[model samples]
Target: MKVKNIVRTVAAVAAGAMLIPLAACGGGTAADSGKTKITFLSWDNEQTMSPFIEEFEKENPDISIDFSYAPPTAEYIQTLQTRLVGNQAPDVFIITSENKNDLIDNGYVLDMTGKSYTEKLSQANKDFVSRDGKVYGQSISSWAAGIAYNKELLKQVGYDTVPSTWDEFLDLCKKLQDNGVSPYIEAIGDGADRIPDSFTGAILADKGIDVTTLASKDPQTPGANEKEAVKAWMKVYDEGYASRDNVGVSGDDAKTQFVNGQVAMYCTGAWDFSTFEQAGFDWGFAQIPALDKNHEQYAQGSPSPGLAIYSKLDGDKLKAAEKFLDFMVSDWSLEQRSKNGDAITVDGFESDVTEQYKDVYENNLKTGKYFLMTNFYSNPDVLISTNNAEVQQLVQGSITADQWAENIDAKMASAQ
Candidate 1:
């Protein structure tokens, strides 16, 4: 899911909550025209969701969707939470890794078990949003976070492609640095942990640990096996492959640096093609590097956010909600979403992804390593805030790599 999209149209790593007076939030009755009105709260800006909503309404005249108001993740969580506790939540809303636990544990989301639309859903999507083996959220699409390389810049260092292993990667970075080129940069100011996190998950996965299980657990927990992952990540900075000053850069700045040829590599996802393609230089993507020659690359991901219903919805309103979700995964909706740049989830959903991304997708096909590591952590703040802060410290040499790992382990333990 997008933590990748914050730089683009905002990709979805399926990830959100507050209390208010009943009517103040969304306490509307059915429409007088005999249409069942369902309120939808989304993390997507209204402009992004408008066309999809319009199309859904056009198809199902019996249901009307009300997007009273919705903001991005940080704020939407607070606003939606107040409404949920006040019994005024929108009828249809999003369930992400951050909010999945509270929503499912408190019975806020409807149980979607055995729904026909879910039959062909990917196990990755199902596992991300489910609790106790029952599905709750309808994850529609996905994207991956990886390294984007400047093909021309790397060519100056005599490399045709990004290296597959970390030790080799350091050599490449050194060659570029010696050539007066900054080897890599990522917007660490805004949750830039995805690159390191994805690579770490790959290392752990090759060790036979399913990172999804450890996602909600602290990495430094006794026997957790996350230490090696953190050590490898710290090496990229510790060994001078990337800059410590990157702590001040934002995602946009990283993109701009790459465009200006100020940097030879960038850590981000596929969403930035619109900007990158405009660059004067030739570029391509690389699977995230692994720990050594033995490990396979892994990228962080989750099913894109899908339609979810409030548990209390019933009768015609319930039917409408289910129908809307059904329609979302229908061939038409999947095709439309895929056309608009989403890497959709439904099996056999053909995507309009470009030749460049075809390589990225194919790299992970055999391993199915779309790692949803941080999202599996129940407290959204851990990935959104804490992990970033700790990673910054690791980069700036304020904390040892082990200390950073310990910080996250403690955070996860506290979350539990």
Candidate 2:
């Protein structure tokens, strides 16, 4: 999953303390074990990754994984950066949007350009971790976030599904509120707002605009495209269909509200399906509505972080790392990942994501009808941080949409 979706509460431990005796990979320091010990710094927690590690070790008896954990987004990046600088980088670790540029540009990650393991990856997954046609990481799954609505709640307003267009969506929100239901809740307090990003994708695609141009270090007009999208998205706040109080809500809080049946629709992804199932509520997931009839629907999404090997590795260590990556996309591993609710994007592999996620998985992830600001933008962390602050102000009625867009442009310019 992307940085925006991961929890940031885990403290990142120092890699120095966790490095095995075989930290210097080409050396035979662990010869006593008679197995190639591969050090892996995992972005996913131990609970989720242990099963895969166990299975891989059981199958490949000649290899051993010396595993360590660092939670995603900021902490993991910082920890990995420190380790790389100290010449103590793990043999394998996650390479995500937040650090792919640094890892590839600095020659810290191995290039898998013609690797057979990458042959199964979809184009979108390959592109996510590639630079200049050279692939660096092996990403297997992708995720899409869209409108998740309470089925029974929508029926109360005489609707069975979310509207297909933005205007109609707002009208439905109004009707839901009129019927004494909390219309919508999305966390605008953290990162970029999903709805406006989806709108931006639809608008850019409709106009045949390539997002990479706008995402460059020096765009001709920094926020020109986003202005229209932000304006369109502000209608939800301007019409009072959704509460400005959402500026303080978090993804967890929004999910809690949705589970309690306090809100009719919640903007999220399939990650919460297990919880929703336990909540005992009928729900449906749909692509975020289009900007208008002329535009197609889009969602906010990207490939999950992928496994990248340390570039300096060679000999036995390198072979072991490659074997681990190959095993990750093996049929057995893919099945485990699918069962864990990942929308597996490896070609020829089918994922059994929950029913509520099928529409989003098929129409959004499979079709590449999704966008993420971080995936496209240069200095992505700056853009997301600025966007979170700016959007909260926009919804709180402190800044007009024009001003909000200008502020983001100014921030992007200053950051460059």
Candidate 3:
């Protein structure tokens, strides 16, 4: 109990102070037996990511990945935002369409400006997660929503394949109905407000006029292109091509109908390939049959977001985090993703996707007929629930297509 004892205590406290900078899970990386530890938060469920994480850990034994998840869309974004603002976000996580810009603007996303991994990324991916060439995300895949068909159903209607052209598509729809099969079905559930809008957009894009390139903010108010596009979209419902039941349906319900043989075709994204694989029938993918022969195929699409780092990360930990991103786009990861029905899309990354989405990968993406709604208009909300309501009314005959166009312009104006 003398000065010597006090000095010893002081030295111990100072040594602990030197290691005060905290790491993940309330401890430093050194706590895990000298392995640099990093956390990865994802929108994907644990079941989907568990096996991948095990492989990643096996390949890089020096770095341990602590995976966490939240349901996609709103729940995921909200959880990530709350944690990041509280200075407790994961070392790496997904940068979704909803949270990408906000994360970048706040300087929360790391700038992999000169990293070798940034060199061979796709333009669509780069542009989405970058501001003026500073990359903040690693793109793993690109997705497009288009026409999916049941091959066997078409044969019963005297066709080997669905037709490509507005008139022919409609005629084919009629034939299927006459044969007691529902020709087409769409799930207009909330954010799934894309089917009709995609049709309208394709009609516009076919004529070399897209909403992104419009001379007027409200194309419908400015020219015949918008009006014609609306009419084309409405014609499907007006003439009973896609049944009215679509309005009451959700994506899962519509998919169920298609799988059960109640419908001949589905208008959806490639994400549905997994579910359709169990349909117990032959099926194939098709580009939204060129709006008509004159116009090439047009579909809705976007580059999928990827693993991003916290801007403040550095040292061996930062290096380890980069390794995870590299692994995400590596041939191994892409192959794993492709096997699960994803279309791999990193610039230099290649993997074999299922044949059902071959048309989307080979033809549609190359020709630029695939457009993300973000390119056309960035609405205030991600779901577009209001737009869905208006479209529902329009399809129900309570409103005209012109009124539908007006409602969207109003929403656009309100958002602006």
User: Which model scores highest in TM-score?
Assistant: 2
TM per prediction: 0.85, 0.87, 0.77
- The sequence of per-residue lDDT tens digits that candidate 1 reaches over residues 1-416 is 35532211222232121222222222244343778777777767666667777788888877777765555564555566767887777788888766677787788999898897676677667767776678888886777766788898999989998888878888999999999988988787766756555666666666676434554444435213455666777777877878888888898999999988889999888878778887757888887777677766777665676567999999998888888788878887778777777776667765767776776665552235666555565665554566677877877889986787677777767756
Q: Give a tens-digit lDDT track for model 3, residues 1-416.
A: 00000000123333334233322231245545868788877867677777677787789877787777665555566667767887887899888556766787789989987676666676556655666557788876677777788889999989887677767888989998889888888786533544444455566665555343332254223213344555776667888878776778888898898888888888887667778887677888787766566666666676676678999999998998888877776677778887775666666555576777777776655334565544333332522455567767876788887776677666565554
Q: Backbone clashes in each candidate structure, one number apiece?
A: 17, 0, 0
Residue-level lDDT tens digits of model 2 in 169-193: 9999999999999899888765437
Candidate 2 off by > 4 Å: 1-34, 207-215, 219-222
What is the Å distance of residue 15 in model 2 from its true position?
6.8
Q: Poorest 10 consecutive residues of model 3 by lDDT?
A: 1-10
lDDT against the true structure, per candidate, is 0.71, 0.81, 0.67
- The lDDT, on a scale of 0 to 1, for candidate 3 is 0.67
Candidates 1 and 2, the one with greater lDDT: 2
